[model samples]
Target chain A: MWMIDLRGIIPAATVVGCILLIWTLAVIPMNAHLAADMAARGDVVVTPHSPQDRKAMTGVTIAVKNPVIIAMTYSLDRPRLPSPHQVAVEMHNTIFTVAPTSRRSLVHHAWVTLSATLLGFVIGTTLGVLLAVGIVYNRTMDKSVMPWAITSQTIPILALAPMIIVMLGAIGIQGLLPKSIISAYLSFFPVVVGMVKGLRSPDAMQLDLLRTYNANAPQGFWKLRLPASMPYLFTSLKIGISAALVGAIVGELPTGARAGFGARMLVGDQYGQPMVTWAALFGAAITAALLVGLISFIERRTLNRMGMGAA
Target chain B: MTPATITARNLDLTFETNDGPVHALKDVSLDINKGDFVSFIGPSGCGKTTFLRCIAGLEQPTSGDISVNGMTPDAARMARAYGYVFQAAGLYPWRTIGGNIRLPLEIMGFSKAEMADRVAHVMDLVDLNGFEKKFPWQLSGGMQQRASIARALAFDADILLMDEPFGALDEIVRDHLNEQLLKLWARTEKTIGFVTHSIPEAVYLSTKIVVMSPRPGRITDIIESPLPRDRPLNIRDSAEFINIAHRVRDGLRSGHVDD
Candidate 1:
């Protein structure tokens, strides 16, 4: 089992390693301006050394390489692109070093965004399921509502976000409600489409069998359709949760809110702190990955209990 | 008179499609008595299964009348007068074998104790004992069909309508299941309407064999078996059984020739 697990881990680790190598290489070219400025100001003390001497030097020794430019890129105070370690250091400082309740801490901002995401996910899932049931059972709803649902998604969320935030603000409904509404708007579509497909998954033979038993519509829905839809529903929820997080973060961007990952990015951009922005972006990504992982965990347990093994 | 358990008078069903109207069943008439093991045998598109569905009230005849236990098929359906077993087992994969069997009983509001007792009784009748907790995928194709048969019998309905239930199984398993079905029929004493394409299967299990033709499906022959009720598998080798099987085969050949 451990060997099988290693097979999966090895590919993922290799991909991550490749990405880090690319990012490290890209940083040298991107931050070359700052490095050049620092060198001109005589801030970089470069000591020329032989390759053998460089190998002999201790860890504390600041020996510049043959190019001398690559070493300057690693220590720039204001870089166009921060190195991976620079972002890591910034993340550690904001997430662990500071108090969690402080606005400067990444944890506080992430918590604010997460609350909206969760609320939106709940509302969106409920609405999506209800609409799916309606669409499945009634021909009129299928003909009328489905096309409109698809049309609604074509309208870009980025273009719609600021207008929604501004409109809600005008009506004095600020803060979490507007953000959550946006999240719901983005997340519900996948659920609606997935659930409609799931609920209709049972074949004609199964339906005829139910009819032979003289089962009513409610009985058919509860006994056959609902259980059949569960696997599809969980798959939709995974997609919906990630989309909801994106919505919440985007919502914070236009509203100029004081606390949230989106607000942190906005502040970082305005104040020219690329490190802060990179840290907050990574924080949001980690949060989204964790949320998706949690939903997958629940999905596995539920499907297993239903005897639908693995999926 | 055994008091006909099912009677059809000039029943016709025409399905209207975008292309045109297709006659699935036309001018078909038959009578099935109580405790009868009747098999409808025909080629594909012969509407043998359609006739069974009409009796189960899953399909409606365009004209004429069909009655079950001296009432309309719809009324009989609402009364839960029969159990249907599809070609595929059609067992809900999410539910265990026991749970699948218990479904109709639960829908009809049977008490918990009664449901448990009935499920166990039917499971034993189908020889599916001790497999109550296994899901449909965990069981073999033959076992799944047995579980389906057990499900239909769970409600203690007076009639069982089976649409080629063992059609998907291998010959060895099908033969074994055929013997079990005969035993089940003897023990339960219920009227069964079976549909099949195999002549030997029709001869082996059915007390009455119905031969039908396609292109507006209608019955051409109805042969009543003179064999005893307690039939073992080796009975298929007997002179009488071979004679009956030959007649069924001839009837089936004549149906296609007429077409």
Candidate 2:
């Protein structure tokens, strides 16, 4: 039997379809000025022949007056809002037309971003779990470290990212390490919170059962606490991965990194190519979705085999 | 004559809560012998489970003398002298029935072969033979409880401490488990300390029944069952069983009046 129900796809798919509908409808108005300018250049009868005058009128008025220009809105080269189809074509071309090693390829940029995300996620999860263990086992650490962990997350990653990048650069550590550090910083908080909850998930009776066996702390951890935390671990991993991806993309943006989704987005915005920027945005989204999907798949397999699938 | 496997004298436990010092156990004393099936039956807050926990070294009595196998309760616990079953089955949801049964063995560092052997044996003992790979959620409540019992029995600990193991089940399931429990007790011949609020449950399984009551929990009466070792389900309806059960009820009522 398949783990996920085919019917389960309908709800999420319907929501995506609705979003696309709304987005596609919004496109006409958003691109109508450019369409109006093109319509005037073609000498298609227009209320205002001047390109500058079209900008003063509402897009709805422009679109309503020149119905022929409506179709033109969906095809502008670099309109204020690129059509979804245009972004899709850009994404497909950038992803498939060039070799994966090419800098222009969306896949290459996505891979660069993903490498940092995966690296940071691994480090963050390990660090988070270690901190969680310390918090759970030692009262001193619980009281002292937990407050700091909570407070650390309050410092917005955007504000901290530049400082981290510049500090690491000043120390002769550049490129992937700085980006990974930012990603790790973003990812660790959820893992710490989720893992602490997971490790302490076992109740008094469960702990007492271990006590009766004269099971030492290590035995209790391995036999009870660790296995008990698997569900929580997976939950945090999914959240951490998305955060890591965001961190990597953010790290790429202000640092002038030459080869990641954030850099592509930055370059596209600067060059006034909305299609390139939109493609990079979609690429980052797809990467995050895939990474989260992989974690969920692993979670199901592990929890099912471990008999904690229902949990 | 069976050796006294567990002994308690003047077991006083107080909890200094915000309300006041709640006397959880007061002047509670009892003796349980090797191979004896003893039941601690009482109302809620009667410290029956607390006393059991004291024996398992899960609780500390402020002023008390308690021993398990001639050692301190904590020492006996660290020595792995007992296995305890909680009110709930409390099986780890992540482990298979077989793996849950093997937990104690694994904890004690048994050889891999020995672990597998003990797991198989206990699973068979609990009639969970084919459920070696089945998860805890896949099993019914009774089966999960059985798996927990098997888990407690996996190692060589001679004392089995159970706190309301069958209390959650319906009458039919509880009856069946109680029967199976007696057989398990007879077969293993381990010293068993069972806690229950049910009078019939206390009367049916225990060789000695300790009747207790609350408001500062204390023992009222200790009744030794006149029923024979080999008893069937129909034995509960017999006059002898009813006679013992009536005395237990009287003991309980008298303790209630004492408060």
Candidate 3:
């Protein structure tokens, strides 16, 4: 009955129009009210007045007069959620006007996170697949290594971040190395678990057929197990890529690095500049989504070529 | 060595499961002569399938020796002494029908050109000519089994081990394939070891029927058929075929009741 009711083009159009109307009614009034309130607040003076009170007052009045500055400062005070217009205008001004080559710009920050995310994904996936093979094939390694990996995750990365940065500094490995390590750590476990299950997913009769053909271990792995595991591997890789982005952002936290999205966040917090921090956050999230989407695209193409695409 | 055919010397196999030790086969000995057709008939778990697997080197005898050709089954396996077909066709789902048939040949290191030619030849043998590019899931069960048998025959193995290859099919399809199998067997002259629970199937197909009993699975009778080698589907309705079928049924009933 419901499907029949939805059959005509007029009904479908009416349903979509109703949804759009509801969303606009729910969002537009609140956004307009918030935008009006933002216009009354002035931006903060981060430079501490430069030993002149009149100059500081002038800066405050100019910030209140600027609608973009007012919107940006209002968003900083309320960081849990910001309206779309507030975020988009901040994105435009910082990315297009304020030092385009600077890492503070959303575009530059996106590239920084993207390069680290891709590098870490490759390293983590390779390591995870190898570990899964060792765990699946060798009982001793499965027994000894799996417990250690499980335990490593229990010690929170928040506490471990400082130790990692200090240790890397002590050994002269700075910048990307420590950050990538954090990404690798967050990403590898899911890949290992997913791959191990996929590699062993062949049914009993299938294994028997391989045996009847007198296939050796390597031959069976190549001809059957590896192909069977591709879908699961891709699934784990998608999860791993997103985790690696989180790790990369977290890795920047303790390094006190001058660049990267995480360092920009710290800088914004120290000076109460909420616009810069919110901009960096949006940049990280977009980078992560793009990485996951790219992996999913490759996964679809690979599975299609292997004849295991979605039916 | 041309190999002393396949000689099983008092083979015994027992399985220790959660329900305690289940003796699946016991004190069975048989010889499959070069180019002979032998079928094993029994109730389920009477060790006919177990015995077939033992010959294929998939299972080891608990207390006896099985020699394929003249070597251990495992050694003969490496030498490609036999090709096996399971109860349900075990075609690789990911591969095309042609690719499935080419598997054994590929394993034996046949070149691409030779593999293609042999695949085409076997496809023609099994009447699967136009379905080469289709995957196993695209075919009917009977056709998939035919593709499986083609796979077995692709490498030209001298011995064929089939475990109820037609048991799942309807009688009409079964009869059709039986005729085709007989023609193929006669044409190729490959020795076959078949396992079936059907009395008519055994009588029509085998030169010798090895009747088996359950529990401590043992062979109770070895009945040789009197039917001539050149027989057809209508032969099943003949007096000679009926007589052989009656003997097989009696052998099965006696074996079942004896325990």
Q: How close is candidate 2 to the true structure, as a TM-score?
A: 0.96
lDDT by residue (tens digit), candidate 1, A1-311: 12468778999999999999999877876665455545645755444333344335432342223246678787676688899999999999999999999988999999999999999888889999999999999999999999999998999999999999999999999889899999999899999999999999999999988888899999999999999999999999999999999999999998788889999999889999989889989999999999999998898888888999644
Q: Pick the candidate with the highest TM-score.
A: 2
Q: How does model 3 fare in lDDT?
A: 0.80
Per-residue CA lDDT of candidate 2, range A1-311, in tens? 46778699999999999999998888889999888877777878887777678878888988888899889999999888988899999998998899999988998998899999889988998999999999999999999998998899899888989999999899899988889988998899999999999999999888888888888899989888888888899999999999999999989988988999999999999999999999999999988899899999999998877766776
DockQ of 3: 0.39
Fnat of each prediction, in sequence? 0.76, 1.00, 0.34
lDDT of 2 at A256: 89
Backbone steric clashes in candidate 1, count: 0
For model 3, residues B13-61, the per-residue Cα lDDT tens digits are: 9999999999999999998889889999999978999999999898888
The window of 10 residues in a row where model 3 chain A has the poorest summed lDDT is A45-54
- Give the Å error, residue A87, model 3: 1.5
What is chain B's TM-score across the candidates, in the order shown?
0.98, 0.98, 0.96
Share of the reference A-B contacts seen in candidate 3:
0.34
In candidate 3, the residue pairs with backbone N, CA or C atoms under 3 Å apart (3 or more residues apart, or in different chains) clash, namely none
Name the regions of candidate 1 deviating beyond 4 angstroms.
Answer: A1-4, A43-66
